[model samples]
Target: MPSAYVARVVLREPVVGARTWAGFATMCTGMFIAILDIQIVATSLPTIQSALGIPPDQMSWVQTAYLTPEVLLIPLTGLLTRLITMRWLFVASVSVFTVASCGCAASGSFATLIAWRVLQGASGGTLIPAVFSAVFLLFPDERQGIATTIAGVLAVLAPTTGPVVGGWITETLSWHWLFLINVVPGTLSALGGVWLLTRDQPSGLLRELDLAALSLLAVSLACLEVGLKEAPELGWVTPITLSCLGTSMLTAVLFVRRTLAARHPVVQLTMLADRRFAVGSALSFACGVGLFGSVYLIPVFLGFVRGHSPLEIGKIMLVTGLTQLATAPLAVALERRLDATVLALLGFGLFATGSALSATQSVATDYDGMFWPQIVRGLSIMLCLLAPTRLALGHLPPEQIPDASGLFNLMRNLGGAIGLALVDTVIYGRVSGHATDLAARLASGDGEAARAVGIPQALFAAHAGEPADPATRAFVAPLIERAALAAAIDEAWILIATLTLVVILALPLVRRRAEPTLEKTP
Candidate 1:
């Protein structure tokens, strides 16, 4: 393991008399709140759409609204640390997030809800980097592993359990409860943060904000996320889609160039020069893409395609969440014995395998088909994430931990955007082709058995509130049902293929390093 020289310096200064346990608790609490808010809203989208009367096409914007600001603001974390005292920045962000949660709960219109969600994302984006900085500052080298274990467990659990929490609220209460639940926790965290967190005065040089870099980063990231999100609906070749993609790419290039040239760049590109950090960051990006993409795909498969209720879908995810929770501690223990890179690669492989299994699912598949795959995925995530985070930040100077964390997280977000775009595009194309073929066959009056498996003529006549002519109903309804089933199956296959590719990519990247071990730490 690395020496505690960096850790000692940070603790002796910013943390003052704070104990390790107290610091850990505070950071964990803060991170839990931030992550919880993001996940809670995800499962409640169905209820939110019904309650708000939002159009089907516009519903995704609720998620995009939050994601846009969150990712866009992530790269600025390093700059924020220099400008404001950590304590004040954390408290202010919690306040913003808390207030926004309340606003979401009280919102009567979709527009108002989206605006509050954007504010919430912007504020919540600062929490993770700040917490990582605080944790690194409080723990010594030997205990850093334990600190990370605690934090990482929570990070994994927040998203895993989100569906369960959201489902319970939406089924028993209302969608508004999703946002309302956040207010209490956020408020409590804000109060706790102010009282417990030690204040660090800002460095005079960094206190002056760089408005130019900030604006450029915000616009560039927003454009990139927006373009990716819109590509599926608008078709990538369409003029409007091409314009958004082109503009996003241009702005991103300018942002990178400006950062490299500026006297005080918002993000330090020099960090990427470190081979370990570079590899670790790449892994993080792939993990993010696979993780978020599956999160989106799984719920859609279970609920919309399979006709499972929100509560039922949530119940299924509970098994996966519990499995991950069980595996996290084991991962921390194994990291002590194994090479971090090997462990991460193994984890990624398991995750990819799980995703492949999930992709093979069909309308007839049951919980048995999903259970083991989810457990494997949970285990893989634990192994993959715990070691890579340590590997990524372990070698950095204590003062630079915040910057490294922020940059790592930013890449993960970007990876998620790219993954979502890629998966959706593939699924869309595959579904369209399958739907067209199925329609054509049904129209040709071929394969009576296949046509009967799709839509029954009597059911279609009942839905129409009149006895449909049997031939007409058979022709139209089977085509519609077959199209829907084909689309769902196509999505599953795409998710499987994407995850398999991720595993293949990760295998070559997992290289062993002859680093010192934890017991040898000074």
Candidate 2:
């Protein structure tokens, strides 16, 4: 109902044209498969490892390989968009992704599958941000809300449904079908998409690649991502990790200098000079942290501590997707009429509240107990996703949109990388400290510890390391670890809550969109 009213109020004509919808549909299909692939692979990693004889330790690289390039390529989207044009870029990315999917499905070796995944990730990363550009470029302002809302839901829904979808394929068919399933949709998304959006306008004329900048950028992000991923397992200060960190710093500094001096930089660092864009990009980073970090925390908590199956956790997580689906239409409807900054304030506040509430969780917290926080986060994330784009590019000039889009989107991924690292530090670093403290407190038959874990003095005296029943050993160890873990997670949740509240300082940077200055040049 509000969509109609907002359309009427904002537009003199119908905004959702046939071509517009067709273009948007193509984008949605591509993005869905892209996102869904990530989650599916995650759930099916064990099977994949078994199939390819991948070492348990190296199996994580399957994901790391994909994400490193994805993160690297994301910042260079504007350059790519300018180099090949949006039409061809979209087609090529989808095509390569499809081909990579085929390669992964047919892969006979661990190395081969990882190679294909890297290709898939590079291609897929392009489409994820492109979806947003399409929302602004393919549609008019009045209709952007609806388009963005739909696309946002697809992105959010993929994570929610991934475990279920991955579980189903593994149980019913086989893991190969997970990759194979993408072939049809990805093909259509590529071929049909190009044919539908046949028109093109030159955005960037920079024909040459900034090789130095590209190299530094690639190394910097690759190191940063890999370093963060490895930090929890291998101590952060370990030699290899320190080298990665140091290398990332060096390359990052060089990349910034190189890009600043270059005539046609791969990433438009200048875009951040705009006050609104800078603030918006920062907010996007925070949003990325919220989105990816929360997703990481939930599955981890449920799997490691709560002992819930992936399927059950997936069902619990579906509440977020459902809540997002329910609220998206209204958020999109308000996007045009409401000041983006105001909506952002409301979003950050609710998100902070939800994160704070979750911090109070105990070992007993379950699906229903966490339900309201899911709803709060779900509703807030829509605003988080939608508002940053509006705040950043909504006010920029026509020619600045593509570069700004790339920069804006990059912040989100960077946030995820940095946020996950922080989460790990909290869990790995804090849990050990908490465990030591907890052990000391429980040393002399502590009453509170007794009441909390339900272990009597006699059981507490039993050494966990002794030869014991498998069931008893598992139970006792987890009981001790869970106590320490619960405290650590609560502390991490509080940290996340504090971070969300910190977004308020950036709210003032988001000015009202200049309606007349807004251009339709996508």
TM-score of each: 0.87, 0.90
Question: What pairs collide in candidate 1?
Answer: 1-516, 1-517
Candidate 2 residue runs with Cα over 4 Å from true position? 1-16, 203-206, 454-475, 511-522
Mind giving the per-residue lDDT tens digits that candidate 2 earns over 1-522? 345444434533335678768877898999899989988888878898998899999999999988888888787777787778778888999999999999999999998998999999999888887777777666666777788788888987897888778877887887789899999999899887888864677666665787778999999999999998998879889998999999999999999998899987888898778888888888888887887778878887887778887777788888888998898878987787788788778888888888888887777788988899898888888888777777887655445566777788889888988888888889998988877776566655566774455466566666433455678647656677887787788888887888878977988765555544333544
lDDT of 1 at 80: 77
Please report the candidate that would top TM-score against the real structure: 2
Cα-based RMSD of candidate 2: 5.2
Question: What are the runs in model 1 whose C-alpha is more than 4 Å off?
Answer: 1-19, 204-208, 439-522
RMSD of 1: 4.7
lDDT of 1 by residue, 297-416 (tens): 777677755678766887787777788777767877787777767777687778877877776665546588788878888778777666667667766676677788888878777887
Compared with the true structure, the alpha-carbon lDDT of candidate 1 equals 0.73
lDDT of each: 0.73, 0.81
